[model samples]
Target: MEQTIPPAESSIVEFKREWTETARETFCAFLNSHGGRVYFGVSDDSSIVGIDKPDEISRTVHSIFKFAIHPSAESYVQTETLKIKDKNVVMVTVLEGSEPPYYVTIKDNNKKGRVCYIRQGSSSYEANDKEIRSLYRKGNPIPYEQRASANQNLTFLTLAEYFKKSNVQFNEGKYQTLGLKDLNGFFTNVGLWLSDQCTAETRVGFFLGNTKASESDGIFTFSGCIIEQFCKIRDLLRNRFGFKNKIEPYTLSSEGYRNEIADYPELAIREALINLFAHRDYSFENAQATVTSFSNRLEFLSFGGLPQGVTKEMMLLGISIPRNKTLADILMRLSAMERYGIGIPTIFASYENFSVKPALVCAHEYIKLDLPRLQQIPSDLTERERAIVSYLKQNGASSRKQLQDFVKVSYGTVINTLRSLEAKKIVVKQGAGRDTKYALTISLR
Candidate 1:
């Protein structure tokens, strides 16, 4: 069906006095937003002003769309040299594009960058990175995993084993069915990732302290099959971390000698790693999924933050809009992912009864989670400092008066102790003024 393009300058229409370079932005805006039309011979006031050399102007319009726009936007746009009020006007009709984030690429002045624009009333507005991501969300018909892989020759030894264990027969037919390779025999990004020939990096670093300035205890990187990488990373993390620091082990059986402990819960760590593999943006191949361990915390960072329309609070509530549904499905069947939506909740649940819960944060290019270490009481603290720590741990948040009474110290002494504890990162003061209360910090150290 043909669109009834309005002539007056508006959100979906633009008027240009000539075949000017500035029309590039308007064309880009139309491609990114809804489809719109531009009148080459029309003035900004919507008056029909005839243009000379209509044929030349049409060629120029075609040239601009072909060479000036990124991703080759010529197919989504059309031009018609028509007569309006006896004046020659070139009407360039642009259609809504399937592959969006359209932008003008200017080679002038050696400047390098894209200038994406969205349609505003009677004008075009520049779009930011977040808006560009939203455009990808709207127009991406093929998932990153389903796209054709650069490497056609690939092998999947570990992937085959996982499939065999799951009782899903592995063969060429299964490859097509699982979307590892297409009917045309081209391997997809999914096949590339699971194959032994995979080149993506997942870097893990164990640091002595909370920042990079501290000496790194150990470092390892993987660039093979995703499943094999997961196994190796799991083993390394278990060997380096999965034992109690200062906390005592819990009784595992009726026998008094049966005790077990881990500084970080296994389930939480498992879910975090799985989430990193299944949800990280594979399209952004340059960005590596990273695991950095500090003495105080464990951090997981993945490419591309929460998917479009998903909020931090929504993710916390176990709502998952997977960026790679096909990859997630394959991993889920292989038992790498227990199921959708359980990863975040299970991690939070594992931290229950602890002073600090895991921190989940979203950014434009990545999402990060900081898992604080379990609380450990230092032995060098003054009696009053230790009392405040114990009291806050037991009673949760407390006022200054409550701490003063519980510690059996002078009012001034209680204030000093609370301040000292706050400085030690053991206690966090909450609220202000008359409603002030102090509670144990989620002990990063």
Candidate 2:
């Protein structure tokens, strides 16, 4: 029995006269490529000649896929016999190989090697060295940026605006360049994160007192693309505190100036926000980054602890390794963060003058950073006096000369400030006369 074929050969569809050893090469090709279908008993032209033993051919195809192809692609390949005008054509359907560089087992150059094939145009041929290496890279562990997104239909208005504001060109032409889409025209996970359809959010809760013991305050959530959320959260966190002006005490001369102090250091808050976004585990759908602002403290909670073998001590020492390199790079391009190890150190430095330092609880599942509210800085400190106390807090015990030079003040002024701070219990004097040195009583955070 025979019937006229309906169409010609194409990239995803192929015609074969019979099931031969060469058919394995094409099977390997379909697995290596985006997957395809091969119809046997069909000629190169739109012609079909029925196979005499359809049962035997089907059995042979299954046996080859099960035993011959590398990594056993039998699970992804299936064969069926179809009736075309009284003629039977055996059709084999193949799905894209989960593990790539699918090849037929063979011997080449006196060594056991693989015979790899890839689809090009309407033909399948042996893959070159470059193509084979590429296939090997697409292996058991795929990078997050390369994985296809579950949602294909996505919007990027927010992302486009962010890119534009950063003066970076963002268009369909840059999809692959920016790793927003894969080579097969599917949106990648990176695209999903940058798109308006992103599911991650930032949650903030306002609680009473220094704890969340009783919930009567309020809560706010920021969503959409992580970029937009970052901006919104940054602004919200920034505006929560106001400034205070400090002046020198008992200064008869015009040596005093206004010292603007903030409840929380601006740099510390910014760094915490950036770390929350760039390093926290984005893979976990059950948790999100959050902040809790209480009357006496601010706490930041994030999912996923320090990476393997990393500890809290190392983090405090400014050792940082980003969990997502690609996202980190993108954020850096936007000038959103610093490259070196300044973030954590800056945060710790902001609390340098406090007796009770900030606390960090690092666990396997999550990390919690607790920053005590503004408490150490006395409102009456003059600009020069505050500078002296800050220097002592950071540099430990310092001589009168060191303090005078650091604050660019007269030697007598430095002595008076140190005496005043010592009387206030903020600074402690050591030794006597020329051996005198002052140190902050408050421990570094």
Candidate 3:
């Protein structure tokens, strides 16, 4: 008799009772991250059930590696068989591949079923377009925008018109200056993005409420030219989130002009939108830059996290490392971006006079900039109303019980306050009965 011990499941270790098509995803994941090993004929509890026909299984694994994995993953994989307690176990070892961003081809899907995967802790997840782009860039230092476009027959009517409007020449020589063409005179991805005939899917959605599940107030999709899309999105955002003026008689002067108060600062919104479009990862086909407006805040979500070595604190300190340098340069030439990397800091400074500050969140694969609404509270509102409004502004929607806990008031008092706020259109009630949650209403005026 023989004894064997198997390792527990971990970031670099996985156990499978048998081979499955899904295992190919894990294989790609291991190749994307640090190398990892997979044990076949093993249980989740480290029990070795053993595999039947180990040699045939090994051959089948080899065939899968040869035919299934894309961009050649065979060099990174090795297989062996070991007998313990008279049971045959197959161990498949996978090393981190030098040519990363590997995808496993699944024919069942579309014609091109190249899906990339990445290992996250103990689980494997499908890599987003941004991650795939990052892997491609990591394997090769050249940025995606600099790469030649697959569609060679591209036109730049929109781009030419933009240059004419900006008082910049749009001759053939300017193409090289703007990164529109490579040395061989082929249209680059940047050229395709700027072309009038380009077909990149960019979209914007305005929801009635804060969350995506809320009813859509408006939805707009942009294609064709990148500059045109940028202008369209900027105009739509400005029209939607722009200042709403409220006229109030001046108390300081008896015969003076009225004060004009805006719902949000225009400079802050401008900087945020510019930063979002300028820094978003263009390699991501599935993900688009999104501007979501809730009642109390607006969120600008862009693909790709902070550039390597740049932190959120550094961003606040005006340190900028643009992921798409060509795009940034174009925007800078168009006068959309300033020379110094002060967009983030300028956004923060825009809200200095307001009670709520803008928030900047950097995640593993994306960045989010949240701008809080500068709503004016009615002077006649009670203390409870002010507290409830403040809570909802900071925490989004909340239930009566939750509000009561935060305000330390009676349940009836909370309910009455909520009703009063709702009556004044300050907050809107969602759902009914116990599932009820109150959210601030859109402060357009």
Candidate 4:
């Protein structure tokens, strides 16, 4: 006959015969680790035979652990009956301990106590001194992933292979090559692996995960809204400013002008991207950096107020502190970052070289960096002067009548404003003949 397996976590079952001390140890291990039901009447081979007196057998097993064991173990014991070989049998069930360190005790070895036991896989092993110490230190914790039994079909191919295909370098050795594998089973069984319990869908959306495994799970993603802003500003640079192909891939190659190059330095842009990526507070879902562009300017807006005990002046003056050290270190090793605490200076220096002051607009929870039109002046001008400058800045050259309309000023007032600006050396006019073009003199310093 096919032997009957014990019922799943049943409070009572059949007991057919005398139980062994090893059987008690197995039940204790179950209680200490994860709770389980033990069928006293069922043989290991699954043949079931009912005990003669179910009540007596239940009391015997109960007294064995509660009063018989040295450190009085607590458990839920239940007695039930089952038919085995056409005879009724008694079953004893033991539930897991709310706390652990459930050891085994025997009548012969009465002096020895605290000899704990735990379940490792299907086998019950004597919990050694070292393992017990580790468990005690850990507070007998249980991971949510393990409790939920996520990724029941966990395969290294599912996670590690993807990294290899992504052009990431990894060791070809045994599973040890993957740091995840090297971590004790404790880490893996606890849901450290990419499992259904901790799926990377939305949680990964706001944060940027490391391409490298040691850093963090690769579930983190740069926010979609932040990337949307980057594209918006980049698009404006191309369409309106006539800055054809201005947003180039990040590279060390020398392109554009030999000396003039692009207005923004490659290092400066790199630092900006890195700073925006690294220093951003991942906890703030609404604070990703936002970039925008207008006719001749590109603006980078980022969430996060300035660092503590610092000011807009200090930020422009090149003071910075990183909030995420682990995330930053992994990115730097992959060449995604240049240096820490130096991005602000690098960005400011990029504009300084162009002789145009980069404006910083600090808000309570956000910072808006405004890049004015390429030919616009760094002005402390009144509203009227600003209007004239903004208008003439884009047109290259404008007639007196055009300037009057653009600046919304009277003919006499327009002439005086232009001459006053020219005298200050902030704006200049050039041309041998009447074909003069007025532009703001680049003097960022």
Off-target runs (Cα >4 Å) in candidate 3 are: 1-29, 38-61, 79-91, 104-141, 183-186, 200-223, 232-263, 286-288, 292-299, 354-356, 364-366, 372-445
After best superposition, candidate 3 residue 343: deviation in angstroms? 0.7
Winner on TM-score between 1 and 3 is: 1
For model 1, the local distance difference test gives 0.78
Residue 233 of model 4 has an lDDT of 36
Q: What TM-score against the true fold does each predicted structure earn?
A: 0.67, 0.50, 0.63, 0.34
lDDT of 2 by residue, 341-442 (tens): 567788999879766567888987788888777744564666567667555533457888999898888878788888898787778888999998887664
Mind giving the per-residue lDDT tens digits that candidate 4 earns over 1-445? Answer: 6345554323222222456666666666766666655666665455655556667766777777786554566455565665667765665566766555666674446535546777776576678755664455344443222232323444444334434544666443533333223234332332222322333211111101111211221122222222222333333333233343443442112542122223344455456555655555333433445444332344555665554456777677666556544435534544556567777777777676565666777775656665544443343554555555545434445666777876677879987888877877766776645575566565411
What is every candidate's alpha-carbon RMSD to the true fold? 10.9, 18.9, 11.7, 19.0
Clashes of 2: 0
The residue pairs that clash in candidate 2, if any, are none
TM-score of 2: 0.50
> What lDDT score belongs to each candidate, Candidate 1 first?
0.78, 0.75, 0.77, 0.50
Question: Which stretches in model 1 have alpha-carbon errors above 4 Å?
Answer: 1-17, 39-50, 62-91, 101-137, 161-169, 243-260, 308-314, 375-445
Task: lDDT for model 4, please.
Answer: 0.50
Deviation of model 1 at 339, angstroms: 2.2
- Best-first order by lDDT: 1, 3, 2, 4
Which of the numbered candidates is closest to the native, going by highest lDDT? 1
Count: clashes, candidate 1: 0
- After superposing candidate 2, which stretches have Cα over 4 Å from the reference? 1-140, 243-261, 376-445
